[model samples]
Target: MSETIRLPHKPDAPLSYQFVPGQGPLSTTHLIVYLNGLIAPQSGWRATIDHLRRRWDEGGSRSANHPALLTYDRYGQGGSARDPADDQHGGSHDIREVVADLHVLAQEIRRTKMIKDADASNEDDGAAAADQVPKPKLIFVANSIGCVIGRFYAQTYPGSTAALLFLDSNIANSDQVSLFPDPDAPGFDPHVLLPPDSTVADLRRTRAGYAAHFHPSAPNPEHLDRRNIISLLPLSDGPPLRGAEPDEGTGPRITVVGHDWATFAEEGLRGSMNVPEGLTNRYVNPPWAAYNEGLARLTSADRARGPVIATGCGHFIQKDDPALVAELTDDLLRNIEADSAA
Candidate 1:
């Protein structure tokens, strides 16, 4: 079921969120939260969610009792209202503010689940049984810009987070403007990144939408400076996994899935774009891979699972291959379970 939850600080506006309850015992419940990319709505995850739910149902009794899914629209996108006037970022899409919102959402989910568990326990086994329920394990599944929010959240509240799944995530350092030819430079066509079927009208609409929600004070997406994206980077110091013990093979798991840049180039490069092939092959691809690799290193010193390059996919890995995503998520859950058991 879906509902709107008014932020305690901002009573005037509420965030739109949907929750799919698991079919298992409350003690072993797994909470999977989906974070969407910039400007993308929760509705964009419909296909992927459907596939995941089907997989969950097929797992029989063992899978049926755990792993609930939750997804929400960010402020100013989809059904969620715009940020309140008093917001620190003045309604702009600030990563910090987004992280704060996620923290609040996570807390509320825990609170709601606790209440539900208490009520069930009291009704079935008396009031004394209420205290026996274990807290739900949290797993985040984030895509594109959403990865920034997920990484920050995991760092800020690692004790509560069980794992993170990054899907074609963007790297803050990979946005260097110097790496690509200037769109305004003579003979450097701005339409290089545009799809073959896209018209000028489509480009205009896209630009308009970008200007509307993102902070005007910040650089545009194409010209974003490194400082603007520094917060999105994984913490160098690493997150605090409170109860995790390396000897037991249990700790927060980090999985990174990136698009195969070579495959992207094969499909994206086309007539008269004027972008140098060497620029993409030499300058872009290497750094892109390095960034993904760096993220894996930052998240896990042992590199439990190295960065995965999705061969047949583009930037939107989930959409390109929903089954792959579902499979990976299932693997992650099973790994978490095995670790916990150990």
Candidate 2:
């Protein structure tokens, strides 16, 4: 069942969420929340979430043996009310505001009793279930800009998250200009590197359109300075940063996933922006990998793995590789179980 939550400060913006109880005890204390990319709705997670739910149901319902799952629409996206502060960002909200709302949503998800499907067919009203969710550990499955939002939330509210899965993280330091070749830069030459079909005019036009409307907040409803976030959460080598509170153990479990270069290269053409293959491979791929590398470094060496390239996947890892996404989450679930048993 879908539920609406009203945050105390912003009562005008009600968020809608859909939750399902795993095949565990109704009293389960662990929760998994999936976050959508900036422009996506919660429905973007349907394939992946449905896969995990089926896997849990295989052994039959076990009352709350597994963690409950939650996914919601942020204000100005999906089923949630449009951000009342949309005009404040020139028709969008910034990452800070978005994270602030998530902090409230996280608390509410634990404090309020939300109606959810108990099994494939049964429904339970959450009216009397708040006690079961107190300070419950959270595992966040985040993609693209959602990954940044998750990190900001965990940083502000330490000891709340248990595991994090980052899917093809956005390049936090990109200036919206460096992803492609500069047709106007010094010593620019169209003949040396340009492909046979990719004209100089085509490349220049795309870059202009992208610069005017894409980065930070082009057509997107969320405005964020990609470069600013990295400053807020610098790489491991930059300084000794502390995201988790002191008493909290060695940060949350981190898994980084990057899109396969070939797949993403192909997918890029499917859109209106027909970036030349040579440029995508030469100019776009390297920096994105480096950015994902930085994301992996956000945690300690022992706690992180991969910028695990998702083969046959593009930017939407969950959609392109649903089983892989579920499998990764399942592994994290085991870690949560082990922690709980301890």
**Which candidate gets the maximum TM-score versus the true structure?**
2
For candidate 1, write residues 80-100 as lDDT tens digits: 777664355433556666777
Best by lDDT: 2
Tell me the tens digit of each residue's lDDT in model 2 across 120-208. 23355433443433565667899988887777777767777777899987676665555777878898788975766577787786677
lDDT of each: 0.63, 0.71
lDDT of 1: 0.63
TM-score of each: 0.76, 0.84
In model 1, the runs with Cα more than 4 Å from the true position are: 25-29, 60-62, 85-88, 91-93, 121-135, 181-227, 231-251, 270-278, 301-303
